[model samples]
Target chain A: MDVRSQVSMVFHLDKCIGCHTCSIACKNIWTDRKGAEYMWWNNVETKPGTGYPTKWEDQNIYQGGWERNGDSVSLKGAGKLRGLKNIFHNPYMPVLDDYYEPWTYKYQDLFTAPEGNDQPTARPVSLVTGETMDVKAGPNWDDDLGGSPDYARQDVNMQKLTPAEQEVMFQLERMTLHYLPRICNHCLNPACVASCPSGALYKRGEDGVVLINQERCRAWRMCVTACPYKKSYYNWHTGKSEKCVLCYPRLESGQAPACFHSCVGRIRYLGVMLYDADKIEAVASVPEDQIVQAQMDIYLDPFDPKVIEEAKKNGIADSTIEAAQKSPVYKFVKLWKLALPLHPEFRTLPNLFYVPALLPSVGTVNNGIYNSNTNGLWGGIDTTRLPMKYLASLFSAGNTETVAEVLKRLMTVRWHRRNVTVGDVDEKTVNAALEDTKMDTATADAIFRLTTLATFDERFVIPPAHREESIEMLENTGDVKGNTGFGFKERPARGL
Target chain B: MFNATLNQFLFVIFPYAALAVFLVGSIYRYKNKGFSVSSISSQFLEGRKLFWGSQPFHWGLLILFFGHLIAFLFPRAVLAWNGEPVRLLILEIASFGFGLSAFIGLGLLILRRVTTPRITVVTSKMDVVVFLILLTQIVSGLCVAYFNRWGSSWFAAFLTPYLRSIFVFDPDITAISGVNSWWLKIHVVSAFSIIAIIPFTRFMHFLVYPVDYLWRSYQQVIWNWDRRTIRNSTKHSEGEKSTNN
Candidate 1:
């Protein structure tokens, strides 16, 4: 067992309110520069609508991740020979138009232009060309109107549902939307790393942060093609690929990432997860249906004495182990089994997990009585506003049972709490709800507390990064003492 | 020097001068700006034309290069290989096929540069000049090959001796003058001029070939050229992983 600690994250989709505060926060901190204005490192995508970079999940067009051959898998778009052949021009790469023609208003014109008879307006100009242009599109053009046919009709997930079901989803009253704030998965099996011909992209051994070394990037642009999430962006100015660093500088200092800190709903959870490194390939190579179980099996329990001993032997700090034990991500993902990795079928074995949102309103209160007139306090998963098949495709590789199980556990918690707070839910129905979900009172109560009322510390159990030793090993510590800066001193430029 | 004829300058002075500049300039470039050595490609700007232009051009050029190399280095072997009349016919036909492709590809590329607005905007004067020079060289070489059929069989007897004489510092201008073909002279001089101009242009990228890329692992971490520091940190990271297990 080659035990290694990966700094994993879990976003509880239930609590997400679809505010793009996280997106703005991350953009302001990381991507508000030349060639990067269009990149939103943390964009909150409204599900049922085609996302930023428009229909990124349609791997048929983008060819982003691994595709199953007979027994093994290869990158859908690239291999060694194919990569070299297409190095001159990537056939599958998305251009600026695919994301959006990022624009800024000609504010100078507003200030400097001579006053006219009509209201003088600052016309939108393309950031790339600095030319006055019609405002065509944006990063989140289909923001709140996820159910509208103009945007949601193109959603890749809609293909999984039957025609009738799809038609039902578009119904005015039945139309429901949920936020899916995306960042780089920082996958254990990163196709971007494998696709990079220059080998500029690598997952750091210490923290599992995938970074593109700007100095070494040859601008092959394969990373942009290989990232299934489309998180990697090509900086035309720098002639290099850039991606989300997961705010590693803040992570090392025991602070939440900018997006996480600024999140209005506090949906993001950060923590350490100890997994057996030896199993990564085997787990990732399995059939799509078995991928979730395989991923779960890879993550060794923090409380396991054998795993704990091996972790210490592998040079993991004691504090990090303690933090792993306290990680809400670990509880949500491995223990409570509430969260699932997005598109596990993509087979990247993504590090970021999502607790599938229970979007269907359980019941309405009529005359001060909570009326869930079903078999018990919780209604059937099939009747939820967000269809079971949709969540299943997103989270469980079309395993409706898995999505149902998580939703049942969540519903049990809700019903359990409702019984306590309000007398409308009878004692028998409450017990039945718990029994039907097969969840104990203690687990349900814990889930309720963590989901609803978790403090910042409880939500993000940051492990001590201990980056000094790594840096000291790489350079003369005494010689480096005077300098205090992040990343390369020189700005990366084209042609080298 | 003003009194020197064009042939006198092209044959003797130009060869020596070009060779000297080529060697010195290549060395200077390798030392001062080693990292900037890359074939900066505008393939991303207008790729469809490049697909047609670049593929045939690269293939024809590569095959021609090896053909020239083998013929030059092992003239006796080439003579023996061409003893069979049928083999000579095959060799002549293949050379014509490759040379035609090269000609066509080069013509299309030049046309593309002028027509494609995106590529034209990035095209420097040096790039245009180099393109025209290559076109002239190919045309001259093709004209000689077409006019003097079975020249490859006889080239060993004439040009090889002259080239060998030059390599030995013997300066056999008379032996090259023995061929007395203006087209051949134009081809050789233009080819030499291309060599001289290579270091100053984007052709420097061809020097740092990506041969190592074929067999390497996907993930690579560059350590800013400090081997010892990288090794130590790698060991430390391994230790971190090992103890954590």
Candidate 2:
């Protein structure tokens, strides 16, 4: 019986207000130690600019994960599969400085009196060793698009094209621009786990949560370099590497991860997933564009009796099966098919899905404001009208249509104050608000079916009294109707 | 009378004492630990790159020390082998070059320990002190080399005979003549201080070597008694369950 429990997450980008509540929550919970001052386990970054810790996505500088090889996939620069047989080492990984140099301001620098001054000035100083320099870069530098305009503008070289070419470039730049909030993807094929020389890192079989055993960590730091997301951090003082654990303690108590729970936008959803263990590699290796759809196809249908039978045979608990049957991710990702995987090109088969974001029209800015009818709130500075180059700098590939589509979807997912008196607006009202003010009935039905059925299916069933009694009796007796624990009664022992 | 007193103490007493302590102490420490021909063959065959580098550096430095001891112990014999001027020139050159090589090798070894992350993490505080002391020894040795160049024959005639006389347990009252040069005094004081510090510092590595060298070759053993106990308990429980059934 191979009862492998899988876990997954979805982040509705539209719900994210970019307030960095999640980042702050994660910092206060985990990274607020002496050596961990610079780590932000959860960070929000604006698109178009090189992210915090600078140029993280540029794999050329910090090689990580695997690259495509024709129709197959192989670890980056590792020549062939046969050559990889004896080689147990993984080379690509982040260094200590790949995150940021941890720094703190000295309070003495603020209170100390200047040589000639009558009173002390309240200026901040580096708290770490009292060295004073303007420390700017750290995690989450892109929060709230602080440096958006620079990323929005197109290059002059792009403008030198003919009218048609310029028009295409403009669209390309505008299309490419969108905000990307990132966190540990908790990849299905986690390179960090595979690369650890000591086997100190493991993905839990119960919930598929990855963890590092600090006791076993010899500080080789291979996990730091293997992670493409550059999420792992090295503690210089402790001489060990640390990373996100996905708040397992909280999850066990039926609460969301700290970052997810504290998210200002209420964009995160936690759920169980059931997948055929055999199909994981096959689905993950599919080409990038088809990956999201391929992953959805691999999900076992909850309604199938065969699946339930097989699951029971495999020793899967009823509660886990119930959770998978009702998972919101299974709905949005597999049923309604509205969500997309972040950076499918990474090839780690990331579980976090995003409902794409859509931006309002360029000319519709009312004093640089855009109103979201779904949330009944105003967003600052409609940058949709910005030039293509500027947009290109924010979003990779300079694809405006994809950016707009993603933003629109994201806006729908944003947390709006639930309307209590409105008599429970049907899926039509929600889909109408989401689908550009003119909702199609079929789309609304699909959304409604997913929202309600997915929720209903996820609720775990409390075992009936009779069933519990029977199970407990069987367990105590070590026999159920003539069946022994191992499915056979002990043979008559040979004469001692 | 000054020359007679100087020759008695410097040539006879101090040389023998320094020689006895350095040689007998090192040899006794090495042999008492059961290090012998068998151990030497094992270590020589199994030593790593760091081991090779450290071994040669210590051996070369020790040989250089003996060269100094011989000049002080038997000034007349040394002068007979080569003229006094020629012997003085060779001693000065050899000591300078030996000190330089030791200093460079120590620097490379220290840097290797520091810059290699894994190695740096394992380094102890005592290791740092030992490196600093060796550095001081090299710098002070260079000072003595410089002072010898001004008048090698004159310096050797005064210093060597006086040092050899120290072996006779006679106080060299006149060896201090013209030794007022602060640089030369500093060199002498620092050399004696370094010798005193060697046993206490990571320079203790020299005392422990060859024997300590074998410890690295042996595989580390870790016992898990707790897990074994748990397995035994589980087996006991399983046996009881079978008996009940």
Candidate 3:
């Protein structure tokens, strides 16, 4: 089956509270350097608003990810000859202004300026040019301004909606939004890796973490456009391209990634998954409607004896296989089918899955008491405040049925949990919820525990990274014995 | 006498100087500091005008380069193919078309650099020098081609011999000195100058590929597994038995 183990992640959107704690934690660790001030390796995007770098979903501008050139998927932005042709100027690259120009308040001015009359204030200056600038935008500029005409109305996701529906969404009363916390998907069919003209980015064999080799990076900036998520960034000061490393050093040391570790909502789950490596291209190249199914089909059951045998033969460690068995990501994504990969239409076969948040449209208040038309706790999946069509565009490659199914599964879990905590819900609806899942309360309880109250050990089942063998291959075991996994012995600075 | 010295310097010394610098400098930069060796593409800063300028320039340059190579290296073959008047006229027409496109593209690029604020801000001193040299080369080349019709038919007797003499260390200054046109000489000299400064300029992007990317497979799979790991892992119990013992 050409099975290979990849450390994958799941984020329960229902549990996320839209806090940017994970983003700040990741920033402090990875992207606080000179040219990296603009980079947010972990960003929480508010739905119905253009994301970081603004309108990243607008493929018409950025031109990232893969497109079907018949049966095979070709890089949407760059390929062999096209890379050479555009070597002088990448036509599709996002400018610094496309991402807001990184700026720092001249805090020194606040301290150094002699007291004149009023309170001393800092002026915003561009990080790259050091020129005083009028502050306009930032990484979290549209954080919670969901119904704002400036930000939310510009969301590329609005393209999927009819004009009437779009008009309705922009209304203050009908407006709905949720937080989408994102990191590098570390995809199986990584367009960044494929589009790198210099061949700097590669997926690590042991953990499937995508990493860029600093020595090999020539800063072609093709990876910036080729990545559909706009996750890759060019270090203007260093003359190189950089992106999230997935905190591999933390991973090697058996800790969760910085973003995952600092998640305040505790929505993040980390675990290992085994997928058939051979089917990656075929899965990514499938018709738009069939992409989600194709992606799901490639993830082999870790408990399957034959799949486990194939994984072992492919050099997967025994401990990694064990972790795959315990992976909450596996259960949420594969078994319960509550979690879905973000924008499967991008055809990256993204490893990160999201359990869609419930926001039903029909909730109304009568005499200070909230009521739903359905006798059940929540409305039908089709009646969600965030339209099924929008969720379909985001997660299910425009397939509303799959989005509805995922929503039903999530609502079933919520209903099951409510039945346990309070006895307000009727037995008929409880039985229906159970029947919809085609299971008993035990499965729902397991889903509930993992989603809500799972401990660190339960949420994150990190495999032994097995990077030691690679290190040993490059250097003698004795020479590298006590060395930390952090690459670059010296701190990276500007210029050669 | 001026023409003779110029011919010796341009045809003999200049060719060697440019070739040596182009080869050694490119390799040295590739070995020591590979990342700086890039096109330094200013597209991110400004791109709309670049599409019009870069596309035509690159396409015209590639066609013109191959045409020159075929004429210089195998003049006799090129001449034999163009023996008929119709064939010769067609070839000249095509060459003129490419030359005209390249000139227009270069003009647009120069205009872009001067007019576009973003491009001008990023334009280095070397970028200016390279652009001027290219302009001179293309202008001189176009003049020579227009003034001297059917030069490709007689390339074997003129420039090829001169080039061969330089390669053979014979330094036949008289070969090009007898050509009677300084415009052709200017074109050749400026072309050599462009080659000499290429490694130092953004033009090095065309040559510097430290990694052998041409042959590597599209999908990269980093295999960290070595002998010990391979031995420890097996489809069946065979390797497990060895590890257990």
Candidate 4:
């Protein structure tokens, strides 16, 4: 089977409040440097609004990720022949303008201003040029539906909706939105790794964490276009491309990543998944409509005796396999089938799965008064206010049935929880909801606990990284004992 | 004696010293300061100007570089080809055209480097030094090409022998000293100087050419297993066991 272990994640969209704590935590640790002023490795994007890099989902403009061509897939924008042709100038690359010019207030002006009639102001200055500039945009310029007409109305996912359906989504008082916090998907078929001319970017075979070797990066900036999610960023100062490292140092020490640990919503779940390496090409090459299911099918059941035997035969550690069995990601993604990979049509085989958010219930406005309680708190999964087709486009590659099924399972849990806690929901409806979704009470309860009240240990199941084995293959650890420190010998800098 | 000594210093001593520095310096940089090897592209700061400047400059330089290499490697063959009057004229004109484009492209690049405020922030002392040296080299080269008609023939006949003699450990500057052209002399000295400073500047990117990308598989799934076993999968388990041991 050629079994391999990949650390996977599931982010529950229902509980996210979009506080941006995860983004800040990641920034403070990894990207809060001179060249990385604009990068947000962990960003909370408000759906129905254009994301950080502005309409990143619009592949027609960025041309990121892979396109299925016959039985095999090819990079949509960059590969061998095309990459060499555009080596000097990549026309598809997103400029600094696309991601907004990162700027800072000239705080010194407030402190060192001369006496004047008017109060001294901290004028905005471009971080790139250090010149006074009019602040046009930022990473989170469209937070909380700010500039809805310009940003939210331009959302790429809204294309699947009819004109009338689109209008209802933008109605002043009736609009619905949700927070979509994101990090690197750490895909099995990463186009960034494929596009790098210098062979700098690579997916770590042990854990599937993609990393860029700083020494080898030639500032090609192809990865910036190859990543469909716009996660890879070019550092202007270091003259290299940078992206999320997935907090491997923390994971190696058996702690959750900085963003996962600092997540205010507690919606993030981390775990390991075992997959058949032989099936990745076939799985990724499947038709767009079948991509989500194909991806899920590739993930081998960790508890299966045959799969476990193959995993061990492939040199996978027993502990890692045990972690895979207990992985909350496996439960949410495979066992319960409630979580779906975001935009499977990208053909990246992303490891991060998302539990699609339930839209607000449909409400009727009577003589300028809104009555939301008439149809109860939760609406039918098929007739959500945000439209199932929009969610389908974002999550299941236009498969409304998958989104409907996931939402139905989530609703069953809510109904089951309400019947037990509040008792307002009728027994007949809750039982029928469970039966229709083919979900039992036990599975619903487990999903609810993992989704809502999962402890830190329960949420994150980090397997011990057997660094000694990997290290031995590269260099003698005993020879370098006490000789190396855990920091960069020389800071990454540009110029001769 | 003084003229001979100076010629020996410039042609014999200086070339060897520069070659030594190029080898040792580049190896040291690659091993110790490994993270510093990069093109350090300023395109992100100002791309539009870079496109106009970099493309023509690189294309012209690559063509000219290979042309020189061919002449050096096969001087007799080049001389035989140049025996035809039409072929000789075509070769010279084509070379001059490429040299002119390179000169113009370099001038545009210098202008962009000096004028752009964002680019100025990243400019270092070595960058200025390289730019000035390149400008001198290009200007001198262009002057030699324009002033000395059929210069390619003389280069292959006279200079190629001198270059070959040096490589064979016999320092011969007889042809070079006898020619008595300041433009060609300056061009040779500047070329040697560039070779010396390559490792100390961003020019080191030339050595680590990403030519492997052309042949290697596009999808890089780096398995954490014995690389030998990946190449020869029949001994996969045996190789794995040995590596573990």
Candidate 5:
């Protein structure tokens, strides 16, 4: 089976509150450097709005990821011939203007003003040039204004919706928004790794963490265009490309990643998934509509005796296998089938899965008693604030049934929970809802527990990384014992 | 004796000294300061100007470099081909065209580097030095091509033998000493000077050009330990579909 262990993740979009605490935690840990001021390794993007880098989802403009070519896939922007052809000056590369010129207030001016004016204020200075500039944009410029014409109406996914449906989405009372906290998906077939001319970016075989060897990165900037998610960023000061490392240093020590640990709404789930490496190509090569199912099928069940034998033969530790068995990600993604990978059409076979968020139920209280006033506790998927086609575009490859099926399961869980806890939902309707979605009470309850009330340990099932086993093979660890600092051996500078 | 001594210093001693520095310094930098080896592009800060400057400069330089290499490597073939008047004219004109392109591209690049405020922030002292030396070399080359005329024939007849003699440890200077044009002499001297400073500047990036990328597998998976054993053990096994059954 060519079994391999990947540290997979599931971000429950339902629970996310768009607080950006995860972004701050990630920033404080990794990207608070001179060159990385604009990089947000963990960015909370509001769906139905143009994301960071402005309309990044429009592949025609950004040209990130792969396109299916008959039996195989080719990079949309970069490959051997095309990459070398445009190596000198990449036309697709997004400049600092695309990501918004990072700036900080000239607070010194606030104190050192001539004291002639009635009020003193700090002027914004560009981090790139140290020149005074007008503030035009920011990373989260359209934070909660998902209904605004400038950001939300311009969403690339909104192209799939009918004009009337798209117009209805902008109505003040009917408008809905959800937070999509994004990090590197750490895809099985990563375009960033393939696009790197210097062979600097590689997916570590041990844990499947994609990383850029800064020493070997020649500033080709191909990865910055090849990455479908626009996660890889070029550092102007360092003259290198950087991306999310999935907090591997913390992960190696058996601690959750900083973002996962500090997530305020507890929307993040981390666990090991044992996947069949042989299937990665076939899965990624499939048509866009079949990609999600093909990708999920590649993740082998950890408890299967034959799969466990193959995993052991491939040198996966028993504890990691056990962690995979108990993985909350596996249950939400594979078992309950409630979560879906974001943009499966990208054909990178991304490892991160997202449970589609259920929009707030549309209902009215007739007189006094608070009633949901629908067939069940919640209305049908069609009646939700965000259209099914829009969610389909975001998660599936415009597969509305997949989105509808997941939402139905989530709705059944809510109904099942109401019947159990509150006793308001009648047994007949709840059972029928459960039967209609093909989910039993136990499965619904389990999905509910993992979705809503999972403990820290339950949510983050970190396996022992066994880094020493791998590190010893590469170099003499004893020689590096005295070196504690993390800065480069030779600082990244422009010239000699 | 003084003229002969000067010719020996410039043609033999100076060339060898530069070659020594190029070889030793490059190896040392590669082994120790691997992290600093990169093109160190500033395109992110400013790209539009770079597109105009970088593409033409690179293409022109690459074509000229390979053209010189062919002439030096196959002097007999170049000389034979140059025997025909029409052929000789075409070769000279093509070389001059490429040289002019390189000159114009470099001019734009220098202007962008000097005038653009953002680019100035990243331009180091060494970068300016490299740029100035490169400018001198290109300008001297264009001057030789324009004024000297039929450099293809003369270069094949004289400089090829001189370069070959130096590589073979013969240290012949008469082949280049008889040359009258100062522009050609300056071109030879400045070319050696560039080789000397290559290791100390961003030019070291050329040494590690990713030529293997053309043939190597696109997907790069790095394993700290041996993965062949892992692959072999599973080679005979069926995929997950069979396992499910």
Candidate 6:
């Protein structure tokens, strides 16, 4: 496998407290300017509620991403493949209002005194009409990911749901709903990077981070509409599109991204994962159900000596190899095999992965509820009387069968034990599963290995060679040039 | 000092000349540039709320402008029909109301331009100019409405007579004699200047109205063969030899 090829991220949702510290830190660093106030490079959202500007997850309104057409992948809603052959641009993206309206206080109203007032009261007003208004919705409106329970309870339509339906929905909601703190996933097939009319946006080969060349951005805002995630924001003042840079400056000096570094929950994990750049299209174009497996197949095993030898041969830096060897991402994502990508159906091959949350629930036996001796259930109480439908809906999209299966799987308390690696499973059991499933040995071995690791490593330490060089370069040469003589040279040079 | 013939040329001929320049220049520019009917159609068809704001702002401003134009054209006819005192009172009230509407509408537009992220991106220097000019006209008109002197007789005896004299091959600078209000002169001059600049700025939307409305109501042409044929005819010459040859 080509070594300087792929990039991936792993996020541990268990540690996330939904404080929005990452969002604010990112905003203060990148998007607090005149045109960028509406852009939140990092935002944590509550699921099952109207997010930010509103229901952004409803892709029916703004069609984006790719869809399957026969054996080939094609842009959804785009009429013909031939017509899209020389695509100057792709359509269907979110506008500024799709996220949130830019709001400002009417400063002039602060000095205006009431009819009988002796002193001017500092009453904040909306600058739009010099009228009194309040900050309503914008970025980070639902950082906590509070489920639709609150909205459903109050909504007339939700209130009308049948008792069974409500029960299933609520259960499903509790099981599925979790705070998803998102930044630019910097996907393998980034819609924003592909749709740029000027080729201004690019994903760095070294780190898999997407960046926009501010100088080249002509402000057509095509990328703004093409991104399914709505990560790209148009800078109105500068007449350019801007997005999360993934804090390359910080990363170059061996530090985490601003959002990841400032995350109060320390939920974010930054590292390098080698993937087959050649297989990106194939993996991304696969059927939705098969996509997760395709992605898993692409994750390189850092411990494999053959993979390491191949990486070194392909001119992969020793530092990068070292960094990848002990990366927290590798441990949590590949070693544990617990982290899952957000909306794998997006077909962007998003690098960011989250560990599927496990919630508490009582096991149903015939008609009676068998309460599990676990604190996983909210308030540590049996909730079977509340209607299984609600719980099913919340957790498993009303698929009680799947909910039961998942619940059974999660109830195996050994899986929840800290610092347990998938590799610790008995070889006999792993071989038995592999044989029973007719699965490939390597795949079975990797999955088993991932489940054995104990504890998530927080340190994203770079190799000493790369770290020292990057620090020295940053200190001496203020700007890091893009090309950096890595590829054009015939052979890998000795370290400076 | 007031030549009847010169006044006829100045008030009557000059005003019409200025109006003709404004009207013809705007129309010519609109025709030459062609209407951005596609853009308007797209906005309206998309069920965009901006169209609602833009449509009302344009229509309100148009009605307001025509009201002033009619008053300028036939002061005596208006007064005779309603009597001088009633006419004067009506003009003042109408001007005040018109100014208020213009002020409010323009304020909304400016607010949208400033606050709406998408609109702010598309806004140009000409858009700012058009907004500010209209705002100034409304402010000046309101000032004139508030500080009227001699009421009905002043307009009938001085302004109306002067306007009529200018039409009859005569000039009468003395008609403006009693009206020493700097505010009135400032208002008149500013209104005229705004008219002159309208053709150049996005204020040309005023001239685009009826034609734009008619054009937009029509459907888009979607025949591929017809479009290709038109493209070939417009882009290529039949007599030209092939470049390879």
Per-residue lDDT of A409 in model 4? 85
lDDT of 6 by residue, A1-496 (tens): 6654344566655456677898889989887777677778888775444554355444565555556667655544332331132122233545555565567755555566456736555555433233555666566554443435544343222332586655664664343345668788888767666655444567665566788766445443556655666677766455567888888787776666788777666666677787666676777777765676687778788778988887766546666777787776776566645566666566777788775444444444445755454433222223533333433433222434433433333223233231145555555544443343344455434433343332233345443335544443223221323335433323445679
lDDT digits (tens) for residues A1-496 of candidate 1: 8777788999988889988899899989999997688889899888888998999998998899887777667888876887877775678888777888788998787788787887678899877666688987898889887336778888899889999989888877567889899999988888898888766688776678888866456667787888889999887545567899999888878899999999889888989899998887778788878889889989989999999988877667788889989998899998999999999988888999999887865445589986655563446565787788888989999888888888888888888898888867778877887898788899988998898889999989998765665464344454433455434444344564
Please name the candidate that would achieve the greatest DockQ relative to the true structure. 5
Off by over 4 Å in 5: A361-372, A376-378, A467-496, B227-245
TM-score of 5: 0.93
True contacts kept of each: 0.13, 0.00, 0.39, 0.52, 0.72, 0.00
What ranges in model 1 sit over 4 Å off? A112-115, A361-380, A478-496, B1-50, B57-209, B218-245
lDDT tens readout by residue for model 2, A1-496: 1334467777766556778888888889998886567667677766545665566665666565667677656555222231122122233334334455456545575556567646555444443334455655556554544554443222222332356644533453234334556777777767666555444566655566677766445444555655667677665545456788888666665667788777655566667777666576676677755665576666677667887777666545677778777677776666555666655555666777776544443433367775433323223123443443333323323444444444443333431112222435555445555566233445545554443343322322211123432333224332434453533456445677
Q: Per DockQ, what order, best first?
A: 5, 4, 3, 1, 2, 6
Task: Determine which window of 10 residues in candidate 1 chain B has minimal summed lDDT.
Answer: B236-245
Models ranked on TM-score: 5, 4, 3, 1, 6, 2
- The C-alpha stretches of model 2 lying farther than 4 A from their native spots are A1-3, A70-72, A77-97, A108-119, A122-130, A148-179, A364-496, B1-245
Give the per-residue lDDT of model 5 (tens digit) for A194-253.
Answer: 999989999988789999998889898999999989999998888888999999888888
lDDT for model 6 comes to 0.55
Query: Candidate 2 residues B1-245, lDDT tens each?
Result: 88556544543444455556666654554455321111111111111334434544565577767767776667667666556566656766766777777766666667666655434544568667767766776676676667546333444576765554554666464665556555565555456555554433334334432222122211111111121232244442211111100
Model 4 score (lDDT): 0.86
Error of 1 at A379 (Å): 1.6
What does DockQ come to for candidate 6?
A: 0.02
For candidate 6, state the interface root-mean-square deviation in angstroms to 1 decimal.
Answer: 18.4
Assign candidate 4 its CAPRI class.
Answer: acceptable
Q: TM-score for chain A of every candidate model?
A: 0.93, 0.70, 0.93, 0.95, 0.93, 0.72
Per-prediction interface RMSD in Å: 5.6, 16.1, 4.8, 4.3, 5.0, 18.4
- Between which residue pairs do clashes occur in model 4? none
Q: On lDDT, who's better, 2 or 4?
A: 4
lDDT of 2 at A331: 68
Instruction: Return the top candidate by lDDT.
Output: 5
